[model samples]
Target: MMMIELLKPDYIFESSWEVCNKVGGIYTVLSTRAKTLQDAFPDKIFFIGPDVWSGKENPLFSEDENCLKDWCAYARESDGLKIRVGRWNIPGSPITILVDFTPFYAQKNDIYGQAWCDFQVDSLHAYGDYDEASMFAYAAGKVVESFYRHCLSKKDRVVYHANEWMTGLGALYLRKHVPEIATIFTTHATSIGRSIAGNNKPLYDYLFAYNGDQMAGELNMQSKHSIEKQTAHHVDCFTTVSEITNNECRELLDKSADVVLMNGFEDDFVPKGNTFVARRKKARQAMLNLANKLLGTKLTDETLIVGTSGRYEFKNKGINVYLESLNRLTRDKNLKRDVLAFINVPGWVGDPREDLIARLKSKEQFTTPLEVPFITHWLHNMNHDQVLDMLKYLNMSNAPESKVKVIFVPCYLDGNDGIWNMHYYDLILGYDLSVYPSYYEPWGYTPLESIAFHVPTVTTDLAGFGLWVNSLKGRFSELADGVKVIHRTDYNYSEVADVIKDTVSDFSALSAAEIKKIRKNAAAIAEKALWKHFIQYYYEAYDIALRNAEKRLAL
Candidate 1:
């Protein structure tokens, strides 16, 4: 096949479920990469997302009525579109349009019917968040269609890009309504692949055997898988985040990605020089103070602060494996340093530790351990929580005698989680090491973020980022070299845990100068994963989408 000539889009409109909503990894993907796009396109690039932050103040969105006032008013009066145009509060402050998708719920059946009619999208076996996501996606599509019709001309080469299965409805809608506009669909992780992994099935091993539609029916993921699979086949250019997920897209979605658009991050959020040093110092002090008050043991600056943070998925995020490894570390008598391992996964936290707070206020460090000192915040279901249960099972009381202290921070550290009063990045800066031994991660952002903060991390080969790291190093990466890409198989939970234990032990034994060099190497690896380096993949996707669209239109 002869290569099609590449083309650039005059206008780009990207849509995702997490555009202004800081829900998950997609938020990081779109927000961080926005500046790079903004630099090239200026105001020509726009983001469309669901308006979930109506009554509450969304700190991430800075609303600007002047952005598309005439068009906004026209869309409202003429098309019944309710949207807020603004700038996302990231590096570039790219133009964002938040659509109020509430009204679409009344016409859900009609919308789904139209989708089925136009694109043969299967909503027959729909369940769970399918309706909600579809509605929002439909609304986003309506927003894009309205904008394009009112503002853009046929001569303008426009691209409508939708991210993930949650936003596939919008892409399908745009393709149906606006045939002239090129469409790009990027699935960060295929729904069926995640479902299979989340359900404790061996996805990677049996990836070839499981039919996408059959697994969708089996796992009760029919709706999401249907739309995702169809969108991949229909889009002008289909892409995934990494080579790992590109394989998943091929096997599970039954469509090979035109381009593998690897996720890239920006370092604009990170502090620098004196500010970085000061923040690190502050974070360490805060952590030590809390640990001292909770454990009744005076922790020093030399204490190794280790952490694992993400969504509280016990199996998938490798929180269970992390705990098991920490337990193994706790049993080791050769452990020289006191390890403060933080489980920063968000949960249903009740309140801050009252006793710890009182001690901090009174400047009275307790010589006796507080009740449930292993956790920073009080959880709603104290006895039922998995982390707490695991802690009890392992007898990790965070006592004075224990060399390893595990602290569960069961809340989001959004600068006001009551106990820490520090943002995640601010507090994570103090960590000596981070670990994300994920079993089913598409692209592990936690490990990437840790390395970006110059903290060496241990991730699994199951992670997309881990695979990318392996590609760079030409072998399984080690913590000594900044990233430990442990080969994690479905049945090797214990093996993975043991590897992590050994890695942490080795890292603990490293001299200060050695650790410094490792941290620098970690940051160096992070530099290569930056948007500046990885944005070219997205350009390739755009080029393919445009060329394909041109070919389709000519036909």
Candidate 2:
């Protein structure tokens, strides 16, 4: 087989709303994938993110004033681009620029007007976080622009990649100001597509018939749609995280991706050999201990641990369906073992439950429930909390004699949630099964992460990861295959719930040997999704951008 010669850039500057700030899946995408790029590109790559932390101590960042002291000083003095040069506290520890965009709020109108004039971005209808995100993006563009002009050469091949609609303005700004630099704009999910799906609209079936501009108007999403659509059209190599999102782009943004950059991860996040086993054991014990203390149950190692985790979009993230599935599973007589389902989505959490904390500390295992035993965290409004409300509606008490129980962990498990002091990944490894039956997942990282930790996952064909799994198998997968990609549709909530119920019930009955094989298969599936394999798509994207930049330069 002949190797393809991809265009390698002399310098690469990538910008995102989630670079070092751990907001959502994009943070995982960038942080996990950074090791591969750092290895390949060495010192040629830089990441820019919004300094939302301000002067507060950010655990994710390690400031290095001396590393880029000259540029930091120059950029601040000359451009008013308040930036903190640091290394992100991830595997690669890649150079990161966290720009304070507070200073740019005063210039918001001028920036919006300039974007409108240059790229036809209709920021006139902007609202809420639009101005904030745009100003940050604009600042990132100026940050890159100043860095490029001051510290870089015209002869050096440079590519500026912007992630999501939040960074679309930066890509547009770079194009208008620094045309010498190639640009790539990646949209994980189209603004209109997510809006359509999140609003309970039939997205896939009605996708082609839906006009983006029309939907943007109806949904009051004109500003975001305008920026995203215009950026996709203008970028040298427009990309999406998956093929499904690319389809959304074709219909919603009227532009096809030059390449699909499938999100991938480094295996360094997963523990090795004995450490893996030890950690998995500890995680399981921790979870079981928490459940036993909270519910006052003797849910031992025999219990089947299951969970669903992601951003808490009640309908879109399928928290509703996950709860419904667990509710259905509770009644299924086929469930051979006690199933403990954890709804690990963060919400408007007030604090950790004091009663639960006290119970967790006590040696006595009281055989009774605590108040609001379903959740470990105290939410601001228990009445308005969707997960708790759904639990109440389903009558899903952590009742004794029930075959299954659901627990809502409504806080970020950052090693100090006051309940289980384990990080999200460490806590998640305890699970035998994970589910992300998403209604609007562009790329499902939660399920992918599950499989990486040798945990079988149940996701939907509506998810890009699920589709990719099916493609690998050439047919729909089952729990035994490490990933069970359920068929999910807008109208098939009940059917999807039943499938998850059945899947979890079946997963509970697998023999130890069968379970080991399935776990191995899960690891194998995750290996195929590592950045070593998936980073080729990024190379392809770079080649497209560089060649396009060359064409523009020639003219």
Top lDDT: which candidate number? 2
Worst 10 residues of 1 by lDDT: 357-366
TM-score of each: 0.97, 0.98
Q: Could you tell me which 10 consecutive residues in candidate 2 have the lowest summed lDDT?
A: 263-272
Candidate 2, residue 103: Cα displacement in angstroms equals 1.7
- Assess candidate 1 and give its lDDT: 0.90
Candidate 1 lDDT over 224-264, as tens digits, reads: 99899989999999999888888888888889999888889
lDDT measured at residue 144 in model 2 versus the true structure, 0 to 100: 92
Off by over 4 Å in 1: 1-5
lDDT of 2 by residue, 1-555 (tens): 998688889999999999888889999999998989998988679999989888688999999989888888899899878899989999888999999988888888898888888888999899999988998898999999999988998889999999999999999998989999999999999999999998889998888899999999999999999999999999899999888888899999999999999989777878988999999999999988888888888998999999999898999989999898888887798999998889888899998988988888888978998887888988998899898888899988888989788889999989888889889999888999998999999999999999999898999999999889999999998888889999987799999999998888887788999999999999899999999999989999999999999999899
